[model samples]
Target: MKNKTYVLVIIALITLSFSSMAQRVDRTNFKAGVHAGVPFGDISDLANFEIGLDLGYHWALSELIDAGLSTGFMNVFVNNDTVDFGSFVLEGDFPNIQYLPVAAALRIYPTYDFKLGADVGYAVGVNQGNSGGLYIRPMVGVNVGRSTEVNISYVKISDDYDFSMAALGILFLF
Candidate 1:
């Protein structure tokens, strides 16, 4: 866990330096945004929705390339109508587990308003015994206009579970 935070700090420093040095680099095109969405899978099938906030920062390296970081909360149901995790069945009555994920992303923008990105990072569950884990996220987004876009992402965490979700929200470009 300590190592994970250190790595995230290093990545943030590198990105910040690059941003500062690249004058004329449409940094405004780089953006920060918040997101919330329902995950699909056994959780959704069980009538459980994982809702959380996303703090995303994106830097447009070029017309076609970009990089960024995202950290957020994840709520997973323990038990419900579907299979159970241990004795818990992920359902509406189950509690949402909060996981803090920090990821570095590389994005390819085919159009000024559209992008596809691959994200690599780590996640730490706040609950005891939940174990922090490695994760990868593949995401796509479409810029709606003026710092707003809709995004969808596929996430694999800990090699134990896969999460797929779509978020409709705004990307605030600084």
Candidate 2:
């Protein structure tokens, strides 16, 4: 009976130690960045370029995966030369179109310094008569340091008018 009790206690101690070692620390982060976007396809005929800000909050789900929420503002400038009013050419630079994008973001880290990510969301137009639509962005990046990363991404928005852009950006994570 004494030998059996000692074995059971030793097993319990080993089980407890393994369970503790298997636990990982949870982490949360915030990231923000700015990007320059070049329009493509039919959008290139109307828009010259885009400038945007991105902000997000993410929580680590595992050693290699993160899930988050992201929101951002983007402005797409219209090409003045492309604007034709039939009777006369539109004179001034047209008002810049704006979008507010809200999305669910996911990222997977293949290496300590490399990651691939995607954001799926809706782009809401801030201007009257400007129809908002579905927004999708897929990106790849490398961490430059402990707190900064550089990324390149493609963004697509679909609505009454479909448009897409390619962007390069830098983000600070905290």
Candidate 3:
């Protein structure tokens, strides 16, 4: 919990600095943009799909360099098996194990509409059973419009328990 707070603070500070410097950039050459993406992944034996939404603030650090703060909620579902009270077996779906991830990533643009990035962040699970997990994802994104993008990544959490796929449907700058 404390770690999550600190990461958010750091991202906030960086964003503030970027916002202040954005006006000074050449308006025609560089611009900042906002993006939102939905990321999907698979959890181990628990759920078929793990999905999340990301909201990011991006700055064109350079033509080839970009940095941003990404925050989002991820839902991880699992199956729970319990025995019935002197009866047949009982099973049902349960609420998702949720996560809040705050991350910073560097994106490199290889072409006008293609981008690749690597991200590192702290994932704090919002469930009591799962305290939290830390993870890293390397992704590929394609710009579909001035305000939209799509991306995919492979993500893994520490302790080697879960490895999953992450797909993002994004809204962002051109």
Candidate 4:
């Protein structure tokens, strides 16, 4: 599809740019990751789970800090059947929520295998009648190997209403 082609082209361009930056930065690396989470808050009754991918370029700013740009896709599946709580009942049949997250990434390493970071940016809506909103995720990670890291993060995407969750993710560095 034309839309897929456009996204491929953009990703290729960004990868090319990061490759050039890597030539001058000894600590730079490319990372790709996957995440999944359960919907909570006001949306808990309306949605199920979400899954996504994270791709980024991270370069060391100092021995203990890393920073770069990050973008990813996330999809929140809508609950199509009516949801019943002990106190009341609500209906479903709503459209799924999806977004493209574009944000700045940063990490602080306190030890060789431990890090803390957050991504702050905007989520571009990918479905009809959705305009998206501000996105923020704070995360903590532990290295599993030289090239793999596992992390836990809390995600918030808010506008008039909020689509929030607690997620677990993993990243592979190259």
The numbered model that scores best in TM-score is 2
Question: Per-residue lDDT of 1-174 in model 2, one digit per residue for the tens?
Answer: 999999999999988765643441233389999999998866776787899999999877666778999999999988776455456555665677789999999999888699999999999988777788999999999999988989999999997766899999999987
* Candidate 3 segments exceeding 4 Å error: 1-42, 80-94
**The 10-residue segment with the lowest total lDDT in model 2:** 19-28
Cα error of candidate 1 at position 137, Å: 1.5
- Candidate 2 segments whose C-alpha is farther than 4 A from its true place: 1-28, 84-93
Ranking by TM-score: 2, 4, 1, 3
Each candidate structure's TM-score, on Cα atoms with residue i matched to residue i, is 0.66, 0.80, 0.65, 0.79
- Residues 46-115, candidate 4, lDDT per residue (tens digit)? 8879999999998776667789899999999888988776588868577888899999999998986999
lDDT of each residue in 1-174, candidate 1, tens digit only: 999999999999988777654752554544555656666664455434555566767676654677878777776644444455565754445445567888897888787688788778998777765576786778788877755777877666663455555545456665
Q: Per-residue lDDT tens digits of candidate 3, residues 31-50?
A: 23322223333344445456
Give all candidate RMSDs, comma-separated: 11.6, 5.7, 12.9, 13.5
lDDT of 2 at 41: 69
Question: What is the alpha-carbon lDDT for the whole of candidate 4?
Answer: 0.87
Return the candidate ranking by lDDT, descending: 4, 2, 1, 3
For model 4, the superposed segments whose C-alpha errors exceed 4 Å read 1-28, 83-92
- For lDDT, the strongest prediction is 4
